[model samples]
Target: MPINSFISLFGRSPIGPMQQHIAKAHECAANLVPFFEAVMAEDWVKVEQVQQEMARLEREADKLKKSVRLSLPKSLFLPVARTDLLELLSVQDKVANRAKDIAGLMLGRQMAIPQTLHAPMRAYVQRTVDASAQALKAMNELDELLEAGFGGREAALVERLVEELEDIEHDTDVMQIGVRQQLFKLEKDLAPVDVMFLYKIIEWIGDVADRAERVGNRLEQLLAR
Candidate 1:
């Protein structure tokens, strides 16, 4: 059977509004990778380029939402599909925005990655990015799983992903505290503004992880129904 037909036989339609939202969310996730990579490399020029790409992706996602709304029947989109799509778009955008905020913080401060904390902090950002991307993938497929009335594995999978994210979040917290302590011990003269900016960037990155974990929780709830 043809690919489309195969999916149709499983009681799913390929031309779903949710699918478009999922694609847009994945685009955000893809954009985040480059942003994290640039930060890790301390490639300031490439960081600006990543920020520009994220802005473009946001515009694309907005256009997609408009197109989807035009095709969908307002009545069919109720508490489930409509709300889920909106939440997905919002969460995806937050990921990109948080990444952009981190880059903006770096640019504004003209701060270079400190040698002592460089490796651990870079690893932390990269891991968080990976978790966010995985969360997006799981969320994007949730509608299909829900519609198919698939086994309990849907919730199980989401739980596992969220658990992994939680683990990473703890590690980030530990690393942040350790780095801050190291900074204070080595240089008591560091600018307050610089410290504030670092805190904001770290908070924003943590927010992205929190949002991704929330998305997983929402998917798990939808799967249970």
Candidate 2:
């Protein structure tokens, strides 16, 4: 089949579906800001609303992931291995999954962000979201990389994006450490269970950035091949 005809028939190139999945995942990550803000205000209603939105976006991203996997042709020729593409999709999907996990944890406990940790927590969330955004941008370049046969300026562009993603993730890690220190300092003032759950929430929020870094690593592996 002609390339354009095959795409028209098959819906889109593999990267297209993958991009949609990452975009949805990014949407889920984007909600973390408002969700955390709501939590800070002790506005359970707004927190629940944001949680629902994250859940909805996560479910939609899951559907897109399934569709992409099922529709991906086994015999279709491409510049990269099918396994690599699948791995990339799986990693990207985890970004959304982590976002939902964070949301669920917050709602389950009605977790409140301590005033001392508010600024650091928000910084952590923003950095994680930024990492996810950069990863998505790198994923967006996959089609272009394919067109360039995975070399030249396109590869250089993605390489730089991956570097930026790594840097953002590192910043989030620092923020996580700082937040943990603050949490520990304030732990004495809170109920023991609240302290435990707060730690869990902070760890899970950091996972979002870790997952985003994994996505970038997967793309780097693809570039290597």
Best by lDDT: 2
lDDT by residue (tens digit), candidate 2, 1-225: 444555676556888889999999999998999999999999999999999999999999999999999988885666667788888899999999999999998898888777888888888999999999999999999888887778999999999999999999999999999999999889889999999988988898899999999999998998898
Model 2 is weakest, by summed lDDT over 10 consecutive residues, at: 1-10
Badly placed stretches (over 4 Å) of model 1 are 1-42, 69-72, 77-81
In order, how many clashes per candidate? 0, 0
Candidate 2's C-alpha lDDT? 0.90
lDDT of 1 by residue, 1-225 (tens): 443454555544423655565466456645655775676677878877877776676667667666665655443322346555566556655665555556666665655655665666666666666667767667655555654453567656666766676676566667667666666664555577766666676667666666666666666666555
- What overall lDDT, based on C-alpha atoms, would model 1 receive against the true structure? 0.61
Instruction: Give the Å error, residue 139, model 2.
Output: 0.7
lDDT of each: 0.61, 0.90
Q: What C-alpha RMSD separates each model from the true structure?
A: 4.5, 2.0
Clashing pairs in 2: none
Error of 2 at 221 (Å): 0.6
